[model samples]
Target: MNLLSDSRCGSEEEVRCLLVLPDINILSHSGVSHTVFWLLGIPGLEDQHMWISIPFFISYVIALLGNSLIIFVILTKQSLHGPMYLFLCMLAGADIVLSTSTVPQMLAVFWVHVAEISLDRCITQLFFNYSTFISESGILLVMAFDRYIAICYPLRYSSILTNSLIGKIGVAIFLRSYGTIIPIILLLKRLTFCKSNILTNATCKYIVLAPVSCDDIRINIWYGFFVLMSTVVLDIVLILHAVFRIPSQDVRHKALNTCGSHVYVIILFYGPGIFTTHTQRFEHHIAPHIHILLSNVCVPIPISEAIKTQALLS
Candidate 1:
């Protein structure tokens, strides 16, 4: 009975959908959503559509090489086994996970034109993508706290930010991020996707999937906002507090220098997140390839900096 239902669900899904495969016209939900149109108005770069995929492919290559070097540097260097480098290693891991979750599938569609995505695969991609994204958020928050104690409370830094303490915090961040995902997944599970299974992008984003549902998704949207807000608010508070406690004029600059790279990272990370969260309409501005490339491929900056920091420490 279950197998029969599953098979029937696959075939009957699209006809039942109102939004994703709306009754308006045949071209309504067929090809990629017209995210490309908005890119045409970008000043002098309007004619660079073909070059968009070129940069995306180049970025994929950089992320692969840079993240691999991060892993290698952390593993091979003996003197780099401190709390800071440990967090760097974890950050590198998150970058690799994030890139792996997004890049190959994107390249497949760009190169081979394979656009169909099954429901199960869509959910799987969402799981990996969100998991890495949240984990990175949580880790960045903890990293901020780590820097806080190191610079502001230097006298007790060793005792306060001990090896065991770092381990416990790492585990807590992972749990907080990974555990928060359960409710979102459960929400998705309950949704009846009565639309085209063929996703427009290379992979599924929960927001993208929500429009296809015959069921009301207010709860899912609110919960997602709650999760995003908590991560952003908490991280910002920690970062601000860390900034406030700088010791002296000379060291203030040094302290800010230490966190500058991460500050850039948080801005880049959360900018798209805000875009994705509030305005689904803005998502149509960039080519899907450009969006994935900027968000996932730009991850190498953190990875490279983490490796360099670890090497200097060693």
Candidate 2:
């Protein structure tokens, strides 16, 4: 039974075939089976897809334009060449990558009824989606530290956070982001996804795809959880701790003022993220479409907020 021999298996009926294939050996025997996964875009809402796609289209456009402008302004303007603006540029770049990673595929699933994704493309998307997210979290933490030094120790700000230091921090952020994610991809590639390849969302996510495999996914789940806690949660804790260390009210206010945009960006990025993670774990009764909607909504908020924040700062 060569799964790849049939055209229907590569198209609309892929999920049905995947669900019906009972034997793992049958899938693995040919060495070419199960190369594609079917993405279910907002399951149970096939009729309302046009309406649902409107918001996604608008959000993607706004995010792309807004983040691009931020990057452009930061790069072209000589006056904006500082540690703070450099971090914002990195954030904007991450937002662009993150948004681009998911939105186009989502649009294809929504508008063209194209839901089948090859494993390689799916894994590539998954890698960029997560690596950019981890990078964004790291950049936010660096921005917080930048604010801390600027306000808490204004005299030593330039001496401590020099361009060389900022460059080193940027490299560290890239290493930290990509280093943690490479193992997840390796783990994913090792799994044999002989079970149903129907993903509940329009885009590929680690949590969504990990369960479709017949092999054990406990390590993937645990490591993903660890990365979330160590990066974003720890960053939030350290940022708050630093904010409280300023003894004087005026200094505290100033520090917080500088961090206000970043704080809002953090809230916008992580608030829905935490909610979605909890819902996925504890609220299994929730409709799959709701998960898709929440995931889509969460990606664009940071770019929108970044644009607003940069406007105010300028």
Candidate 3:
């Protein structure tokens, strides 16, 4: 028997009444609850799990090694202790966390068919995934600010962005990312999933799971939109502004070269994100497999591109 369907609830009418009713006492007696989410993986590609697993595993390994090496080199080489490299270290760290947040579980789905995830674990994964994305956007904004200082005010760069200030900025980035997510998690905890417990993506993203809730999710949707707009969208605008304000042609060229790498990364990170978010929200005619594939692929692209960017900068 499917755990999602409880027989003690006399009929579909009674179950609907119990689920829809705001009475805690009725819900408690109904015993109809969803403790686990069935991850749908790639909806149309179930037979090719092994084939798909191969490339995903390879990407994860490359992302891990690449980001780890970037962090290691930055920490070990004293010559690279400038503000620019320090922020790069933070970016690499965020990439590692972001890639790890979902890839392992994705691999499990592809290899072992371990698709059922406990609700708590699902929430944890969603939180980490979003927090890392937010933190990376924050790091990119800080890096843009670092470049703006270096090019526009070279004499004051060191004095303005001291090691102490960079450390504080790092802390602030983490706090900003995590602060935005905590409320979402709290809101998620109060949600009741009385519909199908099957999640439509390989990973547990907020928007992916929000529709499954039987309760009103307009607040969740609006708040998530607010977070995305305030964080990544705002950062993109500032980064672009900083990129265009350099005074000297020679200095501007150099600044553009540095900012070019960041721009590439930003595009890679946000392009798919915007596409996925809009597609999920508006393009209901789109296939579930497309959403699953895009959501999974977008996370690692930044890490791989960051590795390339770091190499070019070095």
Please, what is the whole-model Cα lDDT of each candidate in the order they appear?
A: 0.61, 0.78, 0.76
lDDT of 2 by residue, 163-239 (tens): 99999999999999999999999999998877655677788988788877888788887888888888878877878
As for TM-score, the candidate ahead, 2 or 3, is: 2
lDDT of 1 by residue, 157-266 (tens): 77888888888888887888778887888898787765434343345667667766667888998898898777766676667667757768666676566655556567
- Taking the tens digit of each residue's C-alpha lDDT, what string does model 3 give over 38-112? 765665566566897787888778878877998899899998898888888888888889989889988877676
The full ranking of all candidates by TM-score, starting with the best, is: 2, 3, 1
Misplaced by over 4 Å in model 3 are: 1-31, 247-254, 307-314
- How well does candidate 1 score on lDDT at residue 281? 35
> Model 2: runs farther than 4 Å from truth?
1-33, 303-314
Clashing pairs in 1: none
- TM-scores for all candidates? 0.74, 0.86, 0.85
Error of 1 at 165 (Å): 1.4
Judge candidate 3 at residue 281 and give its lDDT. 78
Question: Which residue pairs in candidate 3 collide?
Answer: none
